[model samples]
Target: MRLLTQLVWVFTVLAILLAVVLLFTYDVIKVEWISFMEIQPSHRQMEDPLPVPARSIPIEGPVSIPGMLPPENPVEADEASIARGSELFEIHCRMCHGQTAEGNGPIAPFLANKPANLTSPIVQSKSDGSIFLTITNGVEGKMPPLNENLLVHDRWDLVNFIRTLTIED
Candidate 1:
Protein backbone atom coordinates (compact mmCIF):
# COMPACT_ATOMS: atom_id res chain seq x y z
CA MET A 1 0.00 0.00 0.00
CA ARG A 2 2.86 2.38 0.87
CA LEU A 3 4.60 1.62 -2.50
CA LEU A 4 1.36 2.19 -4.40
CA THR A 5 0.78 5.53 -2.58
CA GLN A 6 4.33 6.67 -3.41
CA LEU A 7 3.99 5.74 -7.06
CA VAL A 8 0.68 7.64 -7.31
CA TRP A 9 2.17 10.78 -5.69
CA VAL A 10 5.18 10.84 -8.11
CA PHE A 11 2.97 10.24 -11.13
CA THR A 12 0.61 13.08 -10.14
CA VAL A 13 3.53 15.51 -9.71
CA LEU A 14 4.99 14.57 -13.13
CA ALA A 15 1.61 14.99 -14.84
CA ILE A 16 1.10 18.45 -13.30
CA LEU A 17 4.66 19.50 -14.33
CA LEU A 18 4.06 18.33 -17.91
CA ALA A 19 0.76 20.20 -18.13
CA VAL A 20 2.40 23.42 -16.87
CA VAL A 21 5.20 23.12 -19.41
CA LEU A 22 2.72 22.51 -22.25
CA LEU A 23 0.72 25.56 -21.18
CA PHE A 24 3.73 27.82 -21.73
CA THR A 25 4.91 26.12 -24.96
CA TYR A 26 1.42 26.26 -26.50
CA ASP A 27 1.02 29.94 -25.50
CA VAL A 28 -1.83 29.03 -23.21
CA ILE A 29 -0.13 30.92 -20.37
CA LYS A 30 0.46 34.06 -22.51
CA VAL A 31 4.20 33.99 -21.74
CA GLU A 32 6.19 34.85 -24.88
CA TRP A 33 9.81 35.68 -25.78
CA ILE A 34 9.73 38.73 -28.00
CA SER A 35 12.34 38.66 -30.78
CA PHE A 36 14.19 41.61 -32.31
CA MET A 37 12.83 40.67 -35.73
CA GLU A 38 9.32 41.33 -34.42
CA ILE A 39 10.17 45.02 -33.90
CA GLN A 40 11.61 45.47 -37.44
CA PRO A 41 9.56 46.26 -40.49
CA SER A 42 8.45 43.19 -42.37
CA HIS A 43 6.22 42.39 -45.34
CA ARG A 44 4.10 39.30 -45.47
CA GLN A 45 4.61 36.77 -48.28
CA MET A 46 2.46 37.36 -51.44
CA GLU A 47 1.15 40.62 -49.97
CA ASP A 48 0.19 43.11 -52.67
CA PRO A 49 1.89 46.47 -52.43
CA LEU A 50 0.36 49.89 -53.11
CA PRO A 51 -1.43 50.30 -56.45
CA VAL A 52 0.63 51.42 -59.45
CA PRO A 53 1.23 55.18 -59.66
CA ALA A 54 -1.18 57.29 -61.69
CA ARG A 55 -0.37 57.69 -65.45
CA SER A 56 1.91 54.63 -65.18
CA ILE A 57 -0.34 52.98 -67.70
CA PRO A 58 -1.24 55.02 -70.78
CA ILE A 59 -4.85 54.83 -72.03
CA GLU A 60 -3.71 54.59 -75.66
CA GLY A 61 -2.36 51.01 -75.29
CA PRO A 62 0.51 48.78 -74.13
CA VAL A 63 3.94 49.97 -75.23
CA SER A 64 5.38 46.69 -76.52
CA ILE A 65 3.28 43.59 -76.99
CA PRO A 66 5.34 40.40 -76.46
CA GLY A 67 5.67 37.68 -79.17
CA MET A 68 5.45 40.48 -81.77
CA LEU A 69 8.10 42.67 -83.34
CA PRO A 70 9.20 45.66 -81.27
CA PRO A 71 6.87 48.65 -81.60
CA GLU A 72 7.87 51.60 -83.75
CA ASN A 73 8.89 54.90 -82.14
CA PRO A 74 5.61 56.77 -81.76
CA VAL A 75 7.06 59.92 -80.18
CA GLU A 76 8.84 62.06 -82.75
CA ALA A 77 12.45 63.07 -82.03
CA ASP A 78 11.76 66.80 -82.18
CA GLU A 79 13.68 69.43 -80.20
CA ALA A 80 11.07 69.41 -77.44
CA SER A 81 11.04 65.62 -77.26
CA ILE A 82 14.84 65.55 -77.24
CA ALA A 83 14.85 68.14 -74.45
CA ARG A 84 12.43 66.10 -72.35
CA GLY A 85 14.47 62.98 -73.08
CA SER A 86 17.61 64.81 -72.01
CA GLU A 87 16.01 65.71 -68.70
CA LEU A 88 14.75 62.17 -68.14
CA PHE A 89 18.12 60.77 -69.12
CA GLU A 90 19.81 63.02 -66.63
CA ILE A 91 17.42 61.92 -63.91
CA HIS A 92 17.32 58.19 -64.72
CA CYS A 93 19.96 57.11 -67.25
CA ARG A 94 22.79 59.40 -66.14
CA MET A 95 23.44 57.29 -63.06
CA CYS A 96 24.25 54.28 -65.28
CA HIS A 97 24.75 55.48 -68.86
CA GLY A 98 26.66 58.66 -67.87
CA GLN A 99 26.15 62.21 -69.18
CA THR A 100 27.29 61.34 -72.73
CA ALA A 101 25.86 57.78 -72.64
CA GLU A 102 29.41 56.37 -72.69
CA GLY A 103 28.86 53.69 -70.04
CA ASN A 104 31.11 55.55 -67.63
CA GLY A 105 28.53 56.80 -65.18
CA PRO A 106 29.61 57.29 -61.57
CA ILE A 107 27.62 54.19 -60.56
CA ALA A 108 28.73 52.08 -63.51
CA PRO A 109 31.94 50.96 -61.81
CA PHE A 110 30.00 49.34 -58.98
CA LEU A 111 27.79 47.28 -61.26
CA ALA A 112 28.76 43.67 -62.11
CA ASN A 113 28.07 44.23 -65.82
CA LYS A 114 29.13 47.67 -67.04
CA PRO A 115 26.47 49.77 -68.71
CA ALA A 116 26.45 49.49 -72.52
CA ASN A 117 27.99 52.31 -74.55
CA LEU A 118 24.95 54.02 -76.04
CA THR A 119 27.13 55.79 -78.62
CA SER A 120 28.78 52.62 -79.88
CA PRO A 121 27.91 51.31 -83.34
CA ILE A 122 26.54 48.12 -81.75
CA VAL A 123 23.92 50.24 -80.02
CA GLN A 124 23.33 52.78 -82.80
CA SER A 125 22.87 50.00 -85.38
CA LYS A 126 19.74 48.80 -83.61
CA SER A 127 16.39 50.25 -84.73
CA ASP A 128 14.65 52.90 -82.64
CA GLY A 129 11.99 50.32 -81.78
CA SER A 130 14.65 47.98 -80.46
CA ILE A 131 16.08 50.69 -78.23
CA PHE A 132 12.66 51.58 -76.90
CA LEU A 133 11.96 47.94 -76.14
CA THR A 134 15.29 47.68 -74.30
CA ILE A 135 14.37 50.61 -72.11
CA THR A 136 10.88 49.22 -71.46
CA ASN A 137 12.23 45.76 -70.69
CA GLY A 138 15.70 46.29 -69.27
CA VAL A 139 18.66 44.07 -70.22
CA GLU A 140 18.05 41.37 -67.60
CA GLY A 141 20.41 41.55 -64.56
CA LYS A 142 22.45 44.35 -66.17
CA MET A 143 19.65 46.92 -65.96
CA PRO A 144 16.24 47.24 -64.35
CA PRO A 145 13.14 47.56 -66.58
CA LEU A 146 11.81 51.12 -66.71
CA ASN A 147 8.31 49.99 -67.71
CA GLU A 148 6.87 51.07 -64.39
CA ASN A 149 9.33 53.91 -63.85
CA LEU A 150 8.81 55.72 -67.17
CA LEU A 151 5.70 56.42 -69.23
CA VAL A 152 5.38 54.99 -72.76
CA HIS A 153 5.93 58.39 -74.38
CA ASP A 154 9.01 58.92 -72.23
CA ARG A 155 10.55 55.64 -73.42
CA TRP A 156 10.22 56.77 -77.05
CA ASP A 157 11.64 60.14 -76.12
CA LEU A 158 14.60 58.46 -74.45
CA VAL A 159 15.13 56.31 -77.54
CA ASN A 160 15.18 59.46 -79.71
CA PHE A 161 17.74 61.01 -77.40
CA ILE A 162 19.87 57.87 -77.59
CA ARG A 163 20.01 58.21 -81.39
CA THR A 164 21.74 61.58 -81.07
CA LEU A 165 24.57 60.22 -78.89
CA THR A 166 27.70 59.77 -81.06
CA ILE A 167 31.32 59.04 -80.25
CA GLU A 168 33.41 62.20 -80.70
CA ASP A 169 36.51 61.06 -82.58
Candidate 2:
Protein backbone atom coordinates (compact mmCIF):
# COMPACT_ATOMS: atom_id res chain seq x y z
CA MET A 1 0.00 0.00 0.00
CA ARG A 2 2.92 2.44 0.74
CA LEU A 3 4.68 1.52 -2.49
CA LEU A 4 1.47 2.18 -4.47
CA THR A 5 1.20 5.69 -2.90
CA GLN A 6 4.86 6.46 -3.76
CA LEU A 7 4.28 5.49 -7.49
CA VAL A 8 1.19 7.74 -7.61
CA TRP A 9 3.22 10.69 -6.19
CA VAL A 10 6.04 10.13 -8.75
CA PHE A 11 3.53 10.07 -11.64
CA THR A 12 1.86 13.25 -10.34
CA VAL A 13 5.24 15.11 -10.22
CA LEU A 14 6.10 13.97 -13.78
CA ALA A 15 2.68 15.20 -15.10
CA ILE A 16 3.17 18.62 -13.42
CA LEU A 17 6.68 19.00 -14.92
CA LEU A 18 5.44 18.10 -18.44
CA ALA A 19 2.53 20.55 -18.17
CA VAL A 20 4.87 23.39 -17.08
CA VAL A 21 7.30 22.74 -19.96
CA LEU A 22 4.43 22.68 -22.52
CA LEU A 23 2.98 25.94 -21.19
CA PHE A 24 6.36 27.74 -21.53
CA THR A 25 7.19 26.22 -24.98
CA TYR A 26 3.84 26.15 -26.79
CA ASP A 27 2.91 29.04 -29.24
CA VAL A 28 6.44 30.52 -28.79
CA ILE A 29 7.01 33.78 -30.76
CA LYS A 30 10.35 34.09 -32.67
CA VAL A 31 12.26 37.35 -33.42
CA GLU A 32 14.47 37.36 -36.57
CA TRP A 33 15.86 40.81 -37.59
CA ILE A 34 17.51 43.23 -35.15
CA SER A 35 17.42 46.96 -36.02
CA PHE A 36 20.95 48.43 -35.77
CA MET A 37 21.55 51.53 -33.61
CA GLU A 38 24.58 52.52 -35.75
CA ILE A 39 25.21 52.34 -39.54
CA GLN A 40 28.64 51.77 -41.20
CA PRO A 41 29.54 53.14 -44.69
CA SER A 42 31.19 50.87 -47.32
CA HIS A 43 34.77 51.43 -48.58
CA ARG A 44 33.65 53.22 -51.75
CA GLN A 45 31.25 55.48 -49.89
CA MET A 46 33.86 56.36 -47.26
CA GLU A 47 36.45 57.35 -49.91
CA ASP A 48 36.83 60.76 -51.64
CA PRO A 49 33.59 62.29 -52.95
CA LEU A 50 35.41 64.52 -55.59
CA PRO A 51 35.54 63.11 -59.15
CA VAL A 52 39.01 62.82 -60.84
CA PRO A 53 39.42 64.85 -64.03
CA ALA A 54 39.57 62.94 -67.34
CA ARG A 55 42.84 62.92 -69.36
CA SER A 56 43.42 62.20 -73.08
CA ILE A 57 45.22 58.97 -74.09
CA PRO A 58 47.70 59.74 -76.91
CA ILE A 59 47.94 57.35 -79.90
CA GLU A 60 51.51 56.45 -80.92
CA GLY A 61 50.98 53.83 -83.64
CA PRO A 62 48.17 52.40 -85.78
CA VAL A 63 45.05 52.10 -83.67
CA SER A 64 43.69 48.65 -83.03
CA ILE A 65 40.02 47.75 -82.71
CA PRO A 66 38.22 48.92 -79.58
CA GLY A 67 36.35 45.66 -79.10
CA MET A 68 35.83 43.99 -82.49
CA LEU A 69 38.86 44.31 -84.78
CA PRO A 70 38.55 46.29 -88.02
CA PRO A 71 39.17 44.56 -91.42
CA GLU A 72 42.77 43.99 -92.55
CA ASN A 73 44.15 46.12 -95.37
CA PRO A 74 43.64 44.50 -98.82
CA VAL A 75 47.07 43.76 -100.29
CA GLU A 76 48.07 42.97 -103.89
CA ALA A 77 47.96 39.34 -105.08
CA ASP A 78 51.65 38.81 -104.29
CA GLU A 79 53.14 35.58 -102.99
CA ALA A 80 54.16 36.98 -99.55
CA SER A 81 50.89 38.70 -98.55
CA ILE A 82 48.89 35.71 -99.77
CA ALA A 83 51.16 33.41 -97.75
CA ARG A 84 50.69 35.54 -94.62
CA GLY A 85 46.93 35.65 -95.13
CA SER A 86 46.97 31.89 -95.74
CA GLU A 87 48.68 31.37 -92.41
CA LEU A 88 46.18 33.57 -90.61
CA PHE A 89 43.28 31.85 -92.37
CA GLU A 90 44.61 28.44 -91.41
CA ILE A 91 44.84 29.44 -87.77
CA HIS A 92 41.54 31.31 -87.42
CA CYS A 93 39.25 30.23 -90.27
CA ARG A 94 40.41 26.82 -91.59
CA MET A 95 38.62 24.91 -88.82
CA CYS A 96 35.32 26.02 -90.31
CA HIS A 97 36.17 27.02 -93.92
CA GLY A 98 38.67 24.21 -94.73
CA GLN A 99 42.40 24.19 -95.56
CA THR A 100 41.76 24.74 -99.30
CA ALA A 101 38.67 26.92 -98.88
CA GLU A 102 36.63 23.99 -100.25
CA GLY A 103 33.82 24.19 -97.65
CA ASN A 104 35.00 20.92 -96.16
CA GLY A 105 36.60 21.00 -92.74
CA PRO A 106 36.34 18.60 -89.79
CA ILE A 107 33.51 20.74 -88.40
CA ALA A 108 31.89 21.17 -91.85
CA PRO A 109 29.94 17.91 -91.62
CA PHE A 110 28.54 18.79 -88.19
CA LEU A 111 27.55 22.38 -89.00
CA ALA A 112 23.85 22.87 -89.86
CA ASN A 113 25.05 25.41 -92.48
CA LYS A 114 28.08 24.34 -94.47
CA PRO A 115 31.01 26.70 -95.00
CA ALA A 116 31.23 28.70 -98.28
CA ASN A 117 33.57 27.66 -101.10
CA LEU A 118 35.99 30.53 -101.60
CA THR A 119 37.32 29.21 -104.94
CA SER A 120 33.92 29.19 -106.68
CA PRO A 121 33.66 31.58 -109.61
CA ILE A 122 30.33 32.67 -108.22
CA VAL A 123 32.05 33.63 -105.00
CA GLN A 124 34.77 35.34 -107.04
CA SER A 125 32.18 37.36 -108.93
CA LYS A 126 30.92 38.92 -105.71
CA SER A 127 32.37 42.43 -104.96
CA ASP A 128 35.17 42.69 -102.42
CA GLY A 129 32.93 44.96 -100.34
CA SER A 130 30.29 42.25 -100.28
CA ILE A 131 32.81 39.69 -99.14
CA PHE A 132 34.23 42.06 -96.55
CA LEU A 133 30.73 42.84 -95.27
CA THR A 134 29.95 39.14 -95.01
CA ILE A 135 33.18 38.55 -93.14
CA THR A 136 32.44 41.42 -90.76
CA ASN A 137 28.78 40.68 -90.20
CA GLY A 138 28.30 36.96 -90.69
CA VAL A 139 25.14 35.49 -92.22
CA GLU A 140 22.49 34.70 -89.64
CA GLY A 141 22.33 30.96 -88.79
CA LYS A 142 25.35 30.40 -91.05
CA MET A 143 28.58 32.03 -89.81
CA PRO A 144 29.82 33.75 -86.69
CA PRO A 145 31.19 37.33 -86.71
CA LEU A 146 34.92 37.53 -87.50
CA ASN A 147 35.02 41.17 -86.38
CA GLU A 148 35.58 40.00 -82.84
CA ASN A 149 38.55 37.86 -83.86
CA LEU A 150 40.01 39.45 -87.03
CA LEU A 151 40.81 43.09 -87.77
CA VAL A 152 39.35 45.02 -90.75
CA HIS A 153 42.72 44.91 -92.57
CA ASP A 154 42.98 41.17 -91.95
CA ARG A 155 39.55 40.57 -93.48
CA TRP A 156 40.61 42.39 -96.64
CA ASP A 157 43.81 40.35 -96.71
CA LEU A 158 41.61 37.24 -96.45
CA VAL A 159 39.56 38.50 -99.38
CA ASN A 160 42.71 39.02 -101.45
CA PHE A 161 43.83 35.55 -100.46
CA ILE A 162 40.46 34.08 -101.55
CA ARG A 163 40.73 35.83 -104.92
CA THR A 164 44.13 34.24 -105.42
CA LEU A 165 42.58 30.79 -104.92
CA THR A 166 40.32 31.27 -107.98
CA ILE A 167 42.47 33.32 -110.36
CA GLU A 168 45.15 31.73 -112.55
CA ASP A 169 48.81 32.68 -111.83
Candidate 3:
Protein backbone atom coordinates (compact mmCIF):
# COMPACT_ATOMS: atom_id res chain seq x y z
CA MET A 1 0.00 0.00 0.00
CA ARG A 2 2.85 2.42 0.88
CA LEU A 3 4.66 1.75 -2.40
CA LEU A 4 1.43 2.15 -4.35
CA THR A 5 0.72 5.56 -2.68
CA GLN A 6 4.24 6.79 -3.51
CA LEU A 7 3.78 5.73 -7.13
CA VAL A 8 0.45 7.56 -7.30
CA TRP A 9 2.05 10.81 -6.01
CA VAL A 10 4.90 10.53 -8.53
CA PHE A 11 2.46 9.97 -11.39
CA THR A 12 0.37 12.95 -10.30
CA VAL A 13 3.43 15.24 -10.27
CA LEU A 14 4.55 13.94 -13.64
CA ALA A 15 1.11 14.48 -15.13
CA ILE A 16 1.02 18.11 -13.87
CA LEU A 17 4.46 18.82 -15.34
CA LEU A 18 3.47 17.32 -18.72
CA ALA A 19 0.28 19.37 -18.79
CA VAL A 20 2.21 22.57 -18.08
CA VAL A 21 4.71 21.80 -20.83
CA LEU A 22 1.95 21.02 -23.33
CA LEU A 23 0.13 24.21 -22.44
CA PHE A 24 3.23 26.29 -23.15
CA THR A 25 4.08 24.36 -26.30
CA TYR A 26 0.61 24.89 -27.74
CA ASP A 27 0.62 28.58 -26.64
CA VAL A 28 -2.38 28.06 -24.44
CA ILE A 29 -0.28 29.90 -21.86
CA LYS A 30 2.57 32.34 -22.40
CA VAL A 31 5.49 33.18 -20.17
CA GLU A 32 7.80 36.08 -21.00
CA TRP A 33 11.02 36.47 -19.09
CA ILE A 34 11.91 39.53 -21.19
CA SER A 35 8.88 41.77 -21.60
CA PHE A 36 10.18 43.72 -24.60
CA MET A 37 10.70 40.65 -26.75
CA GLU A 38 7.14 39.55 -27.17
CA ILE A 39 6.65 35.84 -27.97
CA GLN A 40 3.01 36.25 -29.00
CA PRO A 41 1.97 35.83 -32.60
CA SER A 42 1.75 38.97 -34.79
CA HIS A 43 3.33 41.11 -32.07
CA ARG A 44 6.87 41.54 -33.38
CA GLN A 45 7.76 44.53 -35.60
CA MET A 46 9.57 42.24 -38.07
CA GLU A 47 6.44 40.08 -38.32
CA ASP A 48 3.94 40.82 -41.08
CA PRO A 49 1.34 43.33 -39.95
CA LEU A 50 -2.33 42.41 -39.73
CA PRO A 51 -4.09 42.57 -43.05
CA VAL A 52 -6.67 45.20 -43.89
CA PRO A 53 -9.87 44.23 -45.66
CA ALA A 54 -9.91 44.59 -49.44
CA ARG A 55 -11.43 47.77 -50.96
CA SER A 56 -11.14 49.58 -47.68
CA ILE A 57 -10.67 53.29 -48.41
CA PRO A 58 -8.11 55.14 -46.33
CA ILE A 59 -9.43 57.64 -43.81
CA GLU A 60 -7.19 60.41 -45.14
CA GLY A 61 -8.81 60.40 -48.61
CA PRO A 62 -9.59 58.33 -51.69
CA VAL A 63 -6.87 56.10 -53.09
CA SER A 64 -5.16 57.52 -56.19
CA ILE A 65 -6.45 55.18 -58.87
CA PRO A 66 -3.94 54.65 -61.67
CA GLY A 67 -4.99 56.04 -65.11
CA MET A 68 -7.36 58.38 -63.36
CA LEU A 69 -6.49 62.05 -62.99
CA PRO A 70 -4.33 62.69 -59.97
CA PRO A 71 -6.03 63.90 -56.83
CA GLU A 72 -6.11 67.63 -56.12
CA ASN A 73 -3.52 68.99 -53.72
CA PRO A 74 -5.48 69.49 -50.53
CA VAL A 75 -2.49 70.82 -48.64
CA GLU A 76 -2.25 74.57 -49.07
CA ALA A 77 1.02 75.97 -50.40
CA ASP A 78 1.49 78.16 -47.35
CA GLU A 79 4.89 79.29 -46.10
CA ALA A 80 5.17 76.52 -43.54
CA SER A 81 4.09 73.82 -45.96
CA ILE A 82 6.49 75.05 -48.62
CA ALA A 83 9.30 75.28 -46.09
CA ARG A 84 8.71 71.73 -44.94
CA GLY A 85 8.58 70.59 -48.53
CA SER A 86 11.89 72.33 -49.24
CA GLU A 87 13.49 70.52 -46.30
CA LEU A 88 12.07 67.17 -47.35
CA PHE A 89 13.06 67.74 -50.96
CA GLU A 90 16.65 68.55 -49.96
CA ILE A 91 16.87 65.36 -47.94
CA HIS A 92 15.11 62.99 -50.35
CA CYS A 93 15.52 64.57 -53.78
CA ARG A 94 18.56 66.86 -53.90
CA MET A 95 20.98 63.98 -54.36
CA CYS A 96 19.31 63.05 -57.64
CA HIS A 97 17.55 66.23 -58.75
CA GLY A 98 20.46 68.58 -57.90
CA GLN A 99 20.60 71.69 -55.69
CA THR A 100 18.96 73.78 -58.42
CA ALA A 101 16.24 71.18 -59.13
CA GLU A 102 17.81 71.00 -62.61
CA GLY A 103 18.30 67.19 -62.74
CA ASN A 104 22.05 67.53 -62.67
CA GLY A 105 22.36 66.14 -59.16
CA PRO A 106 25.68 64.61 -58.12
CA ILE A 107 24.39 61.10 -58.87
CA ALA A 108 22.51 61.98 -62.08
CA PRO A 109 25.44 61.18 -64.39
CA PHE A 110 25.89 57.75 -62.79
CA LEU A 111 22.27 56.66 -63.28
CA ALA A 112 21.25 54.86 -66.51
CA ASN A 113 18.19 57.11 -66.79
CA LYS A 114 19.01 60.65 -65.83
CA PRO A 115 16.67 62.45 -63.43
CA ALA A 116 14.31 65.02 -64.91
CA ASN A 117 14.97 68.70 -64.42
CA LEU A 118 12.11 69.68 -62.13
CA THR A 119 12.35 73.27 -63.32
CA SER A 120 12.37 72.55 -67.05
CA PRO A 121 9.63 74.02 -69.25
CA ILE A 122 8.16 70.57 -69.93
CA VAL A 123 7.90 69.72 -66.23
CA GLN A 124 6.86 73.21 -65.21
CA SER A 125 4.04 73.15 -67.77
CA LYS A 126 2.50 70.06 -66.18
CA SER A 127 -0.51 70.55 -63.90
CA ASP A 128 0.10 70.52 -60.17
CA GLY A 129 -1.90 67.31 -59.97
CA SER A 130 0.25 65.72 -62.67
CA ILE A 131 3.42 66.78 -60.91
CA PHE A 132 2.05 65.33 -57.67
CA LEU A 133 1.28 62.04 -59.39
CA THR A 134 4.77 61.88 -60.84
CA ILE A 135 6.21 62.50 -57.39
CA THR A 136 3.96 59.88 -55.83
CA ASN A 137 4.21 57.13 -58.44
CA GLY A 138 7.50 58.22 -60.09
CA VAL A 139 8.41 57.78 -63.75
CA GLU A 140 8.77 54.09 -64.55
CA GLY A 141 12.35 52.88 -65.27
CA LYS A 142 13.60 56.36 -64.47
CA MET A 143 12.50 57.41 -61.01
CA PRO A 144 11.41 55.48 -57.94
CA PRO A 145 8.01 55.94 -56.29
CA LEU A 146 8.34 58.05 -53.16
CA ASN A 147 4.89 57.12 -51.90
CA GLU A 148 6.32 54.78 -49.31
CA ASN A 149 8.85 57.28 -48.02
CA LEU A 150 6.64 60.37 -47.86
CA LEU A 151 3.21 60.99 -46.43
CA VAL A 152 0.42 62.40 -48.59
CA HIS A 153 0.70 65.91 -47.18
CA ASP A 154 4.46 65.82 -47.54
CA ARG A 155 4.05 65.01 -51.23
CA TRP A 156 1.73 67.98 -51.63
CA ASP A 157 4.28 70.15 -49.90
CA LEU A 158 6.84 68.79 -52.36
CA VAL A 159 4.57 69.81 -55.17
CA ASN A 160 4.49 73.31 -53.73
CA PHE A 161 8.29 73.34 -53.48
CA ILE A 162 8.57 72.12 -57.08
CA ARG A 163 6.34 74.99 -58.12
CA THR A 164 8.82 77.31 -56.46
CA LEU A 165 11.52 75.80 -58.63
CA THR A 166 9.65 76.76 -61.80
CA ILE A 167 9.13 80.25 -60.43
CA GLU A 168 12.88 80.56 -59.92
CA ASP A 169 13.58 79.68 -63.58
Q: Candidate 2 lDDT (Cα, whole model)?
A: 0.71
What are the per-residue Cα lDDT tens digits for candidate 1 across 1-169? 9999999999999999999999988988885578887886666876754565765755758776668998888787899999999999999899998988999999999999999999988889999999988898799988988876788888888988888887544
Root-mean-square deviation of every model: 8.8, 13.7, 6.3
Candidate 1 global CA lDDT score: 0.86
Report the C-alpha lDDT of model 3 over 48-109, residue by residue, as the tens digit. Answer: 55565788765666648767877877888999999999999998899999999989899999
Tens-place lDDT per residue, model 2, 1-169, is 9999999999999999988777666735343446574344424655644432455332322323446555344456677767777887898789888988888877999999999887777778887767777887788889986765677667777777877786322
Error of 1 at 12 (Å): 39
> Which candidate's TM-score is highest?
3
Score each candidate by Cα lDDT: 0.86, 0.71, 0.85
Measured with C-alpha atoms, the lDDT of residue 113 in candidate 2 is 92
Regions of model 3 farther than 4 Å from truth: 1-53, 167-169
Error of 1 at 128 (Å): 0.7
TM-score-superior candidate, 1 or 3? 3
User: In candidate 3, which residue pairs clash?
Assistant: none
TM-score to true structure, per model: 0.66, 0.54, 0.66
Tell me the number of clashing residue pairs for each predicted model: 0, 10, 0
